[model samples]
Target: MARRKKTSPLEDVLDLLAMLPWWACVMLAAVSYFLLHPLAAPIQASDIQGQGGAMVGAMMQKAVIHGLATAGQHIVPLLCLAAAALSAWRRKQRQSLLTEVAQARNTDALDGMSWREFELLVGESYRQQGYCVAEIGGDGPDGGVDLVLAKGGEKFFVQCKQWKAYKVGVTTVRELYGVMAAKGATGGFVVTSGRFTEDAKEFAQGRNIELIDGPRLFAMIQRARQTQGPSTSEHRESAITTGFPQVQAKASVTEPTANSQATTRPDCPRCGAAMEQRTARQGANAGNAFWGCSTYPKCRGTRATG
Candidate 1:
C-alpha cells in the first residue's frame, strides 16, 4: 500500500527520454523542433480575411494552435536535450560505479551505495553480460521490478534489494515469482546487497530465478569487468578521486584494505561459484576471517582460511 511519488510533467517527459539512448534523445530533440517550428510560424492575417465569422473562428483556432506550438517548439526540444545530457551522465556514472565496485576489496563498497545506485549497478552488470536493460524503477526504492533485462530474445525481470543489514527473505522471492508468471517473463533475478534466507533460495532453485547475494554479486561484477577488458582504469581512478558521498563516508570510518584472498578467490564446494572472505560478526567465531560461499544462506558452504 505504498504511495507512488508524484512527479511533475517535465520530470515524466525527462524520465521517458532517459529510457532511450542519448543519441535517440538528441534525434528526438531535433525532430520535435523541426516539426513544431513550422506550426509555430507566423500566420498571415490576409489568409484569414474573407468569409467573415467562419474565417475569424478558424483564425482563432489557428492562433491557439500556433501559441501552443510556439511554446512547445522551445520547451520540447529543451526537455529532450536535457534528457540527453542526463542519459549521458548516467552512463558515465554507471561505469564509474562498476569500476569502483569491481576493484573493491570487500563488500563494504556495495554497502555504501543508495538503493538507486544499486539498481544502476545491477543494470550495468547485466548490460555487460549482453542484455538490453530498461530501468523502470521510478516508483521508488521499494518498487517492484527494478530492471527489465532482455537477452537472446528472452526477457527477464530483476528486483534489487539494497538491504545492508537483514537478509532477503522468502516473501520477496515469492513476489517476484508471481510477477514473473503474470508478466510471462522467461526468468527472473532477485539481487541483493545482502544474503538471502534459506527459504528464499529453496523457492528460487527450480523456478528459473537466480538469487544473487552480496558476495556473488561482487564476483559477478569482477568477472564482468574482466570480460570487458582494460579500459576501466580511467573510470576506476575517477571513482576513487570523486568518490560517491556515501562510499566516501564509509571509507573514512574504516579504510578499505586489499584482501589477500581476493587474488585467489576460492570456489564453493557445493555450488562451484566464488567464495568470499568474510569475518564473523557474532558468536564464538566473531572477528575470525573465513572463506564463506558467495551464495551464503543459499549454499551454506564455508572453508577455513587458516
Candidate 2:
C-alpha cells in the first residue's frame, strides 16, 4: 500500500484554510493585513525618549512585536490568499467531477476514478444537498469513514467505497452503523461505485443507514446539479415566512390555485417541457399529486411527488 505523504506545518495550515470557503479566506487575508500592518510599522523615537530604564524594556517588547508582525504581515496574508486560491480550485474540481459523472452514459465514470477522487465527488454531492460536509481524510482507499455531514442540527457519517468490481457487503454497512452509534450520529450512508450484496441491502433496511449504489448515486448527483439554486437556508426561511415545510424542487404538494404552486417546479424528464402538479384520478395511486408534463397528451412524461 502507498503511504500518505507527511505535510509541513504551513501545508497543514493551508489545508485547514482550504476547507473554508474561498471568499472567507480572502476576507481573512484582508483582515489580517490591516491588523498586522500597524504593529509592523516602525516605532516613533520621541515616544521612547521620556523614560530611560522603562524605555529599554518597552522598546525591547515593541521591537519583538514589530519583528514578528513584520514577518507575519506578509506571511499570513500570503498564506490566506494561497489557501483561498486552493479552495477555489478544489471547488471547481469538485464541480467538474460532478458534471463528468452526472453526464456519463453509464457507471464507467465512477468506476474509472481513483478512491480519493471518488471521496471528493461524494462530498461534493452532499454539499450540493445543503449539508456542510467535512471531509475526514481516510487512511487508504478502503478507509473507515470518509465524510462528516451536518445539517438541521443533526450529524451524519458517510463512507465512500470506490470498489469497481467487488460488491459492498454487509460487513461494511455494519461497520458504519457501529461507528455512528459510537459517535452519536443521527444517521449514516455507505456509498459505493458498484452494487451492494443482498445481505448488505437487508442490513441497511430500517436502520437509518442509506446504501447508495452507483446508479442511485449518479442520479443523486444529476438531481443536485439540476436543482442547485436557492440554498437550504433560503428555503428554510421561506418556509418559516410562508408557514409551510421546505419544498423540494423535484416534488411539491398539490395546491388549490395554480398561482399558489411552487415556482421552482422541475421540467419534464422526457420532453424537457415545464411540468405542473397533477392528480391521479384512477389506479393504485389515486388522489396522489404528481408532476406531469404540460403537453401531457403529446409528451407522456410524469414524476412522483415527494
Cα miss at 177, model 2 (Å)? 1.7
Q: Report per-prediction Cα RMSD to one decimal.
A: 13.5, 8.7
What are the lDDT figures for the candidates, one per model? 0.74, 0.75
How many Å off is the CA of 171 in candidate 2? Answer: 3.6
Q: Local error of candidate 1 at 102, Å?
A: 0.7
Model 1 Cα lDDT, one tens digit per residue, 1-306: 132378898798798677666777889899999999999989998757658799989899999999999999999999999988988788888888999999999888898788888988998886665456777783543338888765434567889999977989999999888888888887788899999999998888756688889998998899888876534322322232222111111011122347632244655433345677799999899999998877766766566785
Per-model TM-score, in order, reads: 0.72, 0.70
What would the per-residue lDDT of candidate 2 be over residues 22-134, giving only the tens digit for each residue? 77789999999999999999988875754878989989988999999999999999999999899778777888898888878877788778787888899888766766677
Model 2: residues with Cα > 4 Å off, grouped in runs? 1-4, 45-56, 139-143, 229-306
